[model samples]
Target: MIDLSFPLREKVALVTGGGSGIGRATARMFAQRGAVVAVAGLDEAPLLQVAEEIVAAGGQALPIVMDVTSEDAIASGIACLADRFGKLDILHSNAAQTGEMQEDGLIAAMDADFWDRTFSINLRGSMLCAKHAIPLLLASGGGSIIFTGSGKGLAGDLDYPAYGTTKAALLGLSRYIATQYGKQGVRSNVVVVGLAMTEALDRNMPEAAQKLMTEHNLVDHLGRPEDIAEVVAFLASDQSRYITGAAIVADGGFTSHSAVYADMLRFAAMDTGAKA
Candidate 1:
């Protein structure tokens, strides 16, 4: 009996930063497919909303208010989930904050405090989540670990200092995890997302920035959170059993061209500034 559906019927998925953005999307998708879902985020309000939505539609989910940077919080939340669900089959390390999504900053110009906070949330946060979740995954006879990366990760775009660097490092982390744990039956991968119409994008980018994104992408339509969730679900499921150490770029031809023109446009802003 080969079932071709997105079969997550008995699996348990732990999604960090699941309150909103790609995290929220993944949580709902996992629930829909029958995973006993655990959503962790700094805020509980939206986490509750996601859980409630899943519950309303006849799915199981547990919402946990936790911090990605705090080891204790991560350990506690994961321990709790493992206790309730008996095992962890999927770990979605997707928690990060871009400090309101800053858009203009060269490396030397970036604040020291901002740099630390950025890596702490993006890189260290993922590691922290992975550290606690790995044992349970190994206990369940291996599973999948998915990290949310970005287009800026593959390039050095001075548009944002900390965000770009941390994201870039995440791929390295993902590769390491995949290599080290493959023999142990665990698989790791990354999703390098392009511009998506998520809450993060809405809060961080300006209208002009959004306009520029739409113009640059091959797909004129902005990607929705659901788009990313679908990919995550696929990776988490056994259907992708053979895929590992892959940085799946989900950008709609945005990075397909491979030139980060984000910096060149800075001169145009400077030119306008000079005229004034």
Candidate 2:
């Protein structure tokens, strides 16, 4: 039998936006797998809660309140974790902002400040994290860098253009890191997340929109934060030791079907007297 267990025993992981949603799920999952985790976010209360939960569960965790856009803060957070864990093995740059998840229309409607602020958190922040974390990763005999991307990065969208651009940039950055550090045992990959039903999505998206998405999804459901966390865990572990410079889609087949597939399914359902 092939061993499919993803074991990260003794690994040290640092996750941005770990206070909630996908970041929180991934941080907790990493700790559950035996990795000493540092959960970083702008909110200290939620970060502390996550850390306490991990400790209560018999896992090591540190809550770091740091702003990703600040180089000094990123450096301090990385140093704090490194000092405590002795080394850094996994860096999950999961922090992102979608300009309040508003539909910031086409290029004509986008402002310079909007684009800059989006990139500041989505792209540049990831850069700073990698920049400071790489030295520690290298010192720890190489590790993994997991970036969270989105399907919009690959597909064109009429809204949130800035967010899409930043996500695409992350894909490129991940490839660059993989090429530059693969020889040193460091691996880098991007997790292209789909329409996950995170708390933010629940609060922002209407029920009808979510239902329409579910209808289009090949798996017949929206992704959960834990779904993405599972893949992040895989990429962070030795199971994916040979995988790098890759965009692993965790979208529950959302992008796997053709545009007409939903129609086709509807037609079949109608012929079979099933709900379309």
Candidate 3:
């Protein structure tokens, strides 16, 4: 019988952007679930810290300094993973150009260089990583490739046009990979994420803004990094073996409801108060 427990025993996994937030959480979870994780990111400090933390927790981890925007860097990172682990069974391409929301604003005001940079890191980086990792994945007899996408990709937004556009493009890239490599045992899928309470968001978002976002969410609380990590772990494991070329939304119902849902709730509350 197939193992339904979603265990990733002895699997070798790589998580880009594994220094913090969802990537860090997923790397930890993957370790806990029996996978040897290689945490790759641009910064060496956090990567080392995350890897140390995993080691402290009785899991094996390798911290790699990688700049996804550079093909040479990505190729070197993958080579390091292969050198250390011998084979790769799961790859979570979670790195992206972020933290410049204001600069990535409306297309009309978008900086040409900024837009190019966003695509270079967010879209092109993922492609390059896949191109280098596919041979190893196939060597390991097929594996999963999970892309970290965003809800903005599926909906029009007032800002962050470049970010949204790259995320939207990820959906197509994932589908293409899934189609091209499915017969060869590779699976590629996207996880469309919503706002989560990460360090950056918690530090930047105001209380009122958080409250407003919560009101729009169907869930009682905003998402946490661990929440998204769980979804990614599922996709990384064999439990989701039959799933590929699809986008799994883990947005806490942010994209599930109608655009007017939040407003409708407020109007209903007012009507009820008036009747009372």
Candidate 4:
């Protein structure tokens, strides 16, 4: 019989930016799959809330207030997990700074601080998490390190230069980690995130932009935090044991097609007289 369940029984996971959005979803899913989770982030309240929710559901979890950009904070948070769980089987790096949507302008017009801030959080933060978590994961005999990426990282965008640049850097970082430690049973991969209707997006994303995204997406609607969370859980589990140093696009096919997809659909509708 084929075992369809992806069980993470007795595994321990640490998730950065676990307060909300993709991080929170991932943490919850890990718990559901039998993993003990440490939800770490800059905010204490949200982390506490997540931990309470997991425990209330009869799962193991701990809230750790952490700032990923700080090496000391990352180390401390990992140490906390070690003291509590003894070893780590997964590290999900999901924190990111969008940078100044206004200040992360063209190369000539971009602000130095904006670039630095974005890199500090998205790039350096991910590095710190891996650096600190690998030893613990190694102690566990093997584990997964899943870093979050974005479509902006894979493609060029006119805006958010810093955000895109930092995200692109994460893909390279994953490959390096996978190459250096794959023989030792450590796996690293990048999960390229798509447009999701999170609280932040609902407040910030324009209605027109959402409609345009839906038109281009292979699926009828945009992605969700849960969508990215499931992919992260798979990579973290033994189900993806052989998958390493890969960029898995869980974007509902947002980046799978050409920019002219909508235009082609329009033409097809005109010729065939069929609604697309």
Candidate 5:
């Protein structure tokens, strides 16, 4: 008989950007499912808060202050996890450069430094984390590596070219990791996320912009951090054992319809009114 309950029991997981938003939600969910979580992030305060919350909830957690942009920092963080937990069963590389769409715009006008910086944090950071953590995963007899991706990576937009490019690169990187290590029992995947109601999004996006996004979504409401967290938790668990090298789109059907979907709907409504 297959055991379905407590799917992540006894697992040791690490989540980058685990201080807040989807990362924090996922860390909490992992702990709830019986995994000991290590929450890593640039800020010690939020990480500690999250760790303490998990502990308060009767789960084990460790807060590690890690700047994903630095290879040394990433390596050191993983080492610390190994030292404390002795093994790693899951790695959720969820950190990325965010909340700077204006600066990440139009390729022709983009600052070279900004472009490089975005890649450093969004793309290179994941690469470094994987590079350091893969050996530990292998030592533990294989594990899951999940990258937090974006819908922008799948489809082009008029804004945030740098952000989109880096995210798209992650899809390729995920595939490469999956191909290279699948036989060794390691699985790599990307969760291509939609706009969620994270603290940053709520603060940064205008009400009109939020409404426009909601209008395009198939669901009546926009996503929440907990929604994406559920997807990440599923990918991290053994329940998804047969899945690998895949980009699972969890965007509330944001990119599923045609570009003219909304316009078509409006036209249909007009035609119906005219007939009536």
Candidate 6:
């Protein structure tokens, strides 16, 4: 019941890890909707490339080089953006690192260094961004902050404890932000990404694990970055004005096992008065 077109005009957005993958797609989408986008990433090449594309499309964009794990870099980057844009409206924290592979066991066997690095980028990075971006967003009369998540949050994938833990934590973080700042006119939400075809997919997966990805989805094909982007744009816009403290699963129905779940629930509750 809202006008979705150009809902983000005059808004300024920042997409971290915007060099590639879901972050890049989301930055493009925001620019397409007439928002001034700041593309941030540790790698300047991909970040600049995305910004250039947005500019070529007759959209406004600025490329920023930042290391999310470094609080000083994050603070300086936000300062630069604030100086240029005057205010911040949307912050999409999407940067992350894929932890070390598991050879013979679950994540418990995974390297401790990998776990530490994973959390630093995935969890601490988001917190750092939120810390630096909050003031300007508040000055902009409140805005939306969108976290990039994964289906791993809903269910732990074998051998990926680091990734699963971080994604699941992201949901809780977003919820707290939403709960605490709802009255300030700020919104916080997450896009629970399905298996998307990004570089991260091919590099980290083997033949068998990759096959499992396709079977996991209800849709015929695997999820794409754009699929997640569409949802991100919606949450970043006025269209989702009433949505906050929520995690929208955009996984091509990967989690839509309602019938199977219902039967399981009935079985569980059968012993008691309630159905499982």
Best by TM-score: 3
Clashing residue pairs in candidate 5, if any?
Answer: none
TM-score of 4: 0.94
Which pairs clash in model 3? Answer: none
Tens digits of per-residue lDDT for model 1, 77-113: 9889978889999999999874555633776676788
The model with the greater lDDT, 2 or 5, is 5
- Tens digits of per-residue lDDT, candidate 4, 124-239, equal 99998999999988888989999999999998988877898999999999999999999999999999988878988988889999999899999999998999999999999888
lDDT of 5 by residue, 120-153 (tens): 9999999999999999999999999999999999
lDDT of each: 0.87, 0.91, 0.93, 0.91, 0.93, 0.86
Task: Indicate whether candidate 2 or candidate 4 has the larger TM-score.
Answer: 4
| Runs of candidate 3 exceeding 4 Å displacement | 1-6
Q: C-alpha displacement of 16 in model 6, angstroms?
A: 0.3
lDDT of 2 by residue, 82-150 (tens): 888899999999999844655456797777887888899999999999999999999989999999999
Kindly give the number of clashing pairs for every candidate: 0, 0, 0, 0, 0, 5
Output the TM-score of candidate 3.
Answer: 0.98
lDDT of 4: 0.91
Q: Residue by residue across 76-161, what tens digits does model 3's lDDT show?
A: 99999999889999999999887676798777877999999999999999999999989999999999999999998998989888
Over 4 Å off in model 4, which ranges? Answer: 1-6, 271-276
Model 6: per-residue lDDT, tens digit, 1-276?
444677789999999999998999999999988899999999898988999999999999999999999999999999999889889999999999853445313755677777888899999999889888877878888999999998777885565778778999999999999988889888999999888888777786687876665665667778889889999999999888999999999987878775365356556678676532
lDDT pick, better of 3 and 6? 3
lDDT of candidate 4 at residue 26, scale 0 to 100: 95
Candidate 6 versus the native: TM-score?
0.87
